[model samples]
Target: MTPAARVSAAIALLDDILQGAPAEKALTVWARNNRYAGSGDRAAIRDQVYSALRRLRSAAWAGGAGDAPTGRALMLGLLRQEGEDVDAIFTDARFAPVPLNDAERQMPGTAPEPVALDCPEWLEADLRASLGEDFVPVMTTLRDRAPITLRVNLRKSDPAHAAALLAEEGIATTPNPRAETALSVTDGARRVANSAVYRDGLVELQDAGSQALAQAVPVADDARVLDYCAGGGGKTLALAARVSAQFIAHDAIPARLRDLPDRARRAGVEVRVSDAPAQAGFDVVVADVPCSGSGAWRRQPQAKWDLTPDRLAELTALQSEILDDAARCTAPGGVLAYMTCALLDAENAAQIRAFATRHPNWTVTETRTSRPDADGDGFFLALLRAPAQTA
Candidate 1:
């Protein structure tokens, strides 16, 4: 497809998305209907759609007011955001989008300081509370795509061997200091799934911060560990590699763990999946519960825009409830690990503070917070232990 044609496709897809269709759903439907579109064309169109979504506020401001947001206007706004002139592509021709009119051409491009930053208006206060004076820079950074990373399955192979094997397959990766098992995919990310190392499950895709969180859990050989909210079992797989513990995974929604058995098999690890906790007592209960995903807005920009204050309040309540239940499964002298992918103070430090307040008998052993500045997604982990019986 011509460059102009790709722009036209992006506009149409965005229109479908604005009409209540999800971005992925709209893109998939468009791909299925347009069999003539090649892989490159589809990839280019998808990139443009996501790029516009990531900077929606800024793009909207640059495009000026219209009856509603059109694909053409969004593309124009996105080009302006990249400091590119829209005239080169939006030429008046058949099979190409119509050229920008006088109104669009003369539209003032200056963005209000806040909107230019591409953050929701209501979230400004919450962001400030979470990130302090660095909120602006942090939010700006979230506009970029996150790096693809892999966690070397130490149970099967070491990072060096995995890196060498990936390199042989043209997928480049560099060691990450944040997590010993982490390899930041610097290039050739598209080939990961087909790479011999990845296909053999010597390495699994995971963020460095997430790998760090799994590492933080103090696992002992033959220790009984329960993953209380193991959605998709990413952490469960990571934990299995770190220790020879008897790992049992459970989630409120059992469907989430359906693929876990297959994934565990691929990784060559044993993870028992169950809707309820196992009969045996647990030495450690890791509660990696749901959150607003504030720390990962770059990877899923739509989530940041979709979040509302009311929804955030509800999530905090649910998180506290999950923490309490996870604590119950912890045996005497065991540890309760609380985790979330939220950078919001209300969800991280505040929740930990409240947990400590309500459960005075529980002592916080260690609390760690990872920001987006480094090589991975933002995350928080808190290790709390129940008090031992006094003489």
Candidate 2:
């Protein structure tokens, strides 16, 4: 497809997304119907759509309105692309859009403020509270595409050997400092899903920060560990790799763990699935509950725009409930691990504070947080231990 044609495709997909279709769903439907579009064409169109979404507010402002639709966003992105004025492309000709009116032609194209730089206006204060003075820089980092990272299955192979195997398949990776087994795919990331390394389960896609978070949990050999909210079991797999533990995984939505068995098999790890609580108490109970995913807006920009104050409150309540329940599963003097991908203070520090207040017997033993500027998705982990019996 021509560059102009790709722009047209992005505009159409954006329209579908604006009309209530999810961005991924619209892109998938478009690709399915337009089988003639090659891989490169599809990738280019996707980049255009996501780039516009990441800077939606700025694109709207540059297009002369705060509510510019898909076509206007496309035109503004194109304007930034070739440094051409919007008038040059919207000529109302065949295979092109209608010409801009006199007002659009004269529209003021100014850059947006820091809040409008990446996230919506309503989330500004929350972001500030979460990130403090580094909010702008963190949000700026989230405006671009995230690097593709892979966690080597230490149970199967060491990082060096995995990197060598990936290199044999023409994929280059660099060891990530933030995660012991993480490899940042420096090149050939597009082919990773089909590569031999991925097929053999030598590596699995996961953020470095998540790997670090799992590593921070001190698990003993033969220790009984429970992943209480093990959605997709990524953290479960990571934890299993870290120790020879009696791993148990469960989730409120059992369907999320359906593929976990297969994933565990592929990764050559044992993880038992149970809907009911384990009869044996756990040495460590990990509650990686759901959250706003604020730290990962770069990978899923739509989420940032979709979050609301009320929804946030509901999530905090849920996090508290999960923490309370997970604490019960931890043996006396055992660790209760609370985790979330949200960078908001309400979800991270505030949630921890609330948990500590309600359960005074549990003392926070350790806390760790990762920021977008720190080479991984934003995350928070708190290790709380129940008080030992007094003599």
Estimate the lDDT of model 1.
Answer: 0.86
Which candidate's lDDT is highest? 1
* Clash-forming residue pairs, model 2: none
Model 1 Cα lDDT, one tens digit per residue, 168-215: 899999998789999999999989988888878899999999999999
Residue-level lDDT tens digits of model 2 in 132-180: 8878888888877777899999988999999999999999999998989
Candidates in order: C-alpha RMSD to true structure: 2.1, 2.2
- TM for candidate 1 is 0.95
Give the TM-score comparing model 2 with the true structure, all chains together: 0.94
Off by over 4 Å in 2: 68-71, 78-94, 107-109, 278-280, 389-391
TM-score of each: 0.95, 0.94
Worst lDDT run of 10 residues, candidate 2, spans 73-82
Q: lDDT per model, in order?
A: 0.86, 0.83
